[model samples]
Target chain A: MSDSPITSGMTGKTFRVGDFLLKEWEPGEEERIVAAFNRVFAKADPNFRPRSLDFWRWQYLDNPSGKLLIHAEAPDGSVAAHHGFINQRLLLEGRPSLCGQMVDSMVDPAYRRGLQRVSLSATLSNSFIGHTGGEGARLHAFYWGAPVPVAMRIGKALVQYEVVRTQLKLSCAPAEVRLQGASGISVEEPASFPEDTVEFFRKVAHCYKAIAVRDQPQLDWRFVRHPECRFSIATARLGGELRGYAVYSHGSFDGFEEGLVCDWLVHPDDGAAANALWAWLVEKARASSAERLTAVFPETVPDWIRFQEAGFRAAPTQYPFVARTCVRRFDPPWLRRNWYYTLGDTDLV
Target chain B: MHSRHPPPSRTLAIEIRPLQKGDEASLLEALNAHRGGCVQQGHALSSEELAWFLAHPSGTRTLLAWEEKEIVGHLSAARHTMWMKGRQVLFAELLGGFVAISHRARLGKRGLFARLCREFFSEQGIDGDFIYYGWPTREEWRLGRKLLAYETIRTQVALTLSVGNAAEGLPAEVELMERFDHQARWLWDRCAAKFGASAIRDEGFLNHRFVERPGYDYENFGVRDDDGVLRGYAVFRKGQWGEETKGLICDWLVPTDEPEVGRLLLRALEAHGRTQGVQQLFCLLPEWSPWFDSFQRAGFLATDAERMWIARTSARRFDVFWLRTQWFSTLADTLIV
Candidate 1:
């Protein structure tokens, strides 16, 4: 096999290796890609939960920042490998910017070793990175992913994926808790967020050096409209105004019923709202019969210490968060100290 | 060992040279002068200890940045053999990195510390022989990321537990050792596969780090089966931290999957710590290690005092992400002991 001509595709760079066409994903190809994704992942793991077209469209096309996808088409017209990203709007150092959240990287077992002995997934990544971010290209400043173990190795060796943090889960046994005296704070699970959520998030945005812009649209798209799991949200109101909110989901992992704190957003000074939301989550966890309640937040986040004080002990989890910086301004150390993230920022929730 | 005098025109006539036989006093003076500036405040090493620090049985080197006659900065690299990816790889630990207080004001963007690092890193890159790592304070870590291209492998977290009653219901026999014997080596060889990456904890490294090191004492305990085959080993030091007496587990090595062996070793340490009147016990571990979960299951809790673990590697195979997931280290791999 020999390298062939390079042509422009959707992201503006394409490759032809022997008979295989390394090209950009285009319209009307959703079913083909989703089938390939399910096939590849199922071959890799016996218990991989197959992804659906609804999930693919909701994650990639329906996102506010739009979709970016690449694939390698074998001679038989099957997708031998695929790489994709869903762009996210980020508040970087108080400036709005775009970043890509990589997802659904897959390679068929037969085409695992791609062109020139590099993995196909790596080839797709290289092509994707070449066309995005930096200078006058796409506006993405960086790309991040929570990849599986094998993909992580290939990415580290071939694609320069620097580890941002090994995500540590804070977990404790769920216990009953009673709300304290009249703090004028109320907690409830609302069917939908009010129109003022965007304003509230904007007011709280200054507290973070880097974070995802979690407005009403993003929340609705991520939770209420998600194709699979049902996520419950609890909002804390003071004087009948939204002060904070927390999102949670329940599942049984390894035979232990667990309640996951997917997102927690409250002003560092708003202890009352924070406590009310915490009590609500605890009661919810207990009512749902969850043995353990788990939450993940960077140690640099302001609420990390609060959760620790609230009896959440740092425990080990298998997820490793990694990022590739396409822009020079954001390096690992700076990101380590400044980036605020939660489980909601990832697709795992 | 190599000596380099930077281009006199570019740098301010600074000379970066190797440490010679009679340089201990000058180095100690410079280190102690800026004791609390950026470096850690351990008791200043005596001449003998300094000599030992510079002397690795395999290889060691120290580079000093000099402005005419005064040493302005110092850096040292000592060779370590690590078990990584099912094989032994040569690595170096960078230590005693400091810049003199007087020189800080004059160091522009291209300063003496940067000069020393350039000379050292260029030499290492050209040789491409070993990967180097260091434990930097948060401040130093920020500087290192910019100047030295250091990437973090993991943050060091100390797992602490109130010294309680000895562990019970262990199936393995525990034996206390004055020093690591051949069985320790045998055990390490058998169990090295369990870790994706770790400092080689064979008998020689164990003796050098725990038994024969100066100015500190550590108790070595081994776990054995009914046939007396050593399955694991742990090193403990009774020390003072804050206002309490603590038993610090400096080094631990056991197959992470073998809970019985780990429990037996921990029980021995707890019993020994209890006899020594230790109020609490502490062990520094990377969360990536399954043994970290084991310690947590044994009732250890994570504390807030996390230190940065950074590394610079020229090896193509050992990338930052791979090392972050695979590397297993303890306090013994650091200078804290």
Candidate 2:
């Protein structure tokens, strides 16, 4: 395995289990990886939307915070199993720590059963965790992800995945909504996030116990610079200072045309900014002709209650939020009570 | 994606059988000796409470694992009638399962505990409606899912509000009742009509759960309409859990369309709870319940309870997805409060 720490002179070792070769992903293999991902996921889920090569490169190869990709190769040199992690900056108690969000885990159907007793998926996951997870790993401090149901089961039994919370889908009818005007707040659809957005997030970061870094650079990479999908960025300002912002997009979720709140951040005490951004979102959804508007916010987020008050009905979804700590252990109760996340934190949007 | 393998063929010298007459005292002694002999590690049921725990209105059955003449493990399944999709169905609530600490280590996958669960579900399965449900602690939740084939429905949280100094005015139409009367049935009928699934909270269940419990005291409040008929009701218990002295809303029922009645009941409970030296009130109702929004409108916020609802079922209609989306439950439906 290459690109990982050497233990007992194992670096650059060509590890082989029977006919399958386990190794770290190399450059110039984006096309094969993307094709394998599309083929494997489509076989697993009929409704799975295939990813383009450009989308794959932007997501895993070109991420600003670096990438963690490991794969198992079949005898014929096709990618059999691949596990990728996207490095992220997480603010915990106002201290920035590097974290990884697991994404794009797939195994080729033909090689699902490996030569040895261990499965290809398990071999890839074990290698990924051994190299990237635990206390001494320099790659990231911890990892978290929203896994599908089958993966959730296997991860819990094998890789120490603890469920933080099940994601809730809050939906509201967009039509016939009356928008109230905020007295002094102004909302604008900016082409890109302003540089001051980083400072704005820093000013309000201490208000939350745990949150992803939602500064300008991260937001720009996640929403504005994505290869596919377009998001509307609405920034609310009071007297020309950034008070809050909301990013939303219209899409089909479960075959229903709905509006999605990908990311929302407002100062905890600034009700005016929140109200203004919410009004802007309602108008945006109405103009786009979306029948329903939806948002995914953990109960710990302050806006969860506000969304309910704004007539969004919360219901449990199949998606689950799971976390694994490498350097330190976080109590599930404490994490559930304080961790703030939105759909943008996930790869869903 | 491994295939399911059969349990180990090796067997210990343990016999699984149902509890016969005159076995209550021995079961109680064994459970009390180990402290929380039940699988959940809750308070051991007393002699009288044991009878009440096993005496469900629908029916009750207990299976015990025996090594020689000694009871090494036990599991109880109690039948409960609930309204599911507007029709009555009987489901089993698996409870009071505990294994002797000395025997647990030897039980393994083919041990006495696993054998007891297999027999319990086999005897009381989804055939006639034996859908099973239980509120399990973290340890039991893990083991139940692994061995007993339990699926999580949803993790429930508690809605809490601080009882402040400002006194709330109770509606004149509301009255605190000594016991639930026949009008309570009408109130439950109206409330049940609007729910996807709920326990049968008729007059008998109301009295059995709140008024007639042996060791606990609960205050029942009822609200009336202009016609002097009962329109809503709420059961509150001023209890201390750990260090917090709080008011617990054990059960509540009001028609979904009648928000005023719900608000009035909340005001009456808050005023009453404050007088009893409670600084906060806690209610455990599903977010899907219409009354949950009513509680939120009255200033209650959802907080973590560190508990989850899990069930083992052969019935397809009561799958995890449907339960998570449509089921409406309360603290009264569980043994938590």
- Model 1 alpha-carbon drift over 4 Å, by segment: A1-24, A72-80, A108-123, A134-138, A176-182, A252-257, B1-49, B55-75, B79-92, B96-132, B137-152, B158-283, B288-307, B310-328
Residue-wise C-alpha lDDT for candidate 1, range A223-315, written one tens digit per residue: 888888888988888887889999988964323459989888998888888888888888879888888788888877768766766667776
Top TM-score hit: 2
- Candidate 1 residue pairs that clash: none
Measured with C-alpha atoms, the lDDT of residue B61 in candidate 2 is 69
TM per model? 0.69, 0.76
Instruction: Please estimate how well model 1 matches the true structure, expressed as its whole-model Cα lDDT.
Output: 0.74
RMSD of 1: 9.0
Tens-place lDDT per residue, model 2, B90-199, is 67666747888867775567777888888877765444445788776655665665578776666656778889898666667679888888888788787776677778
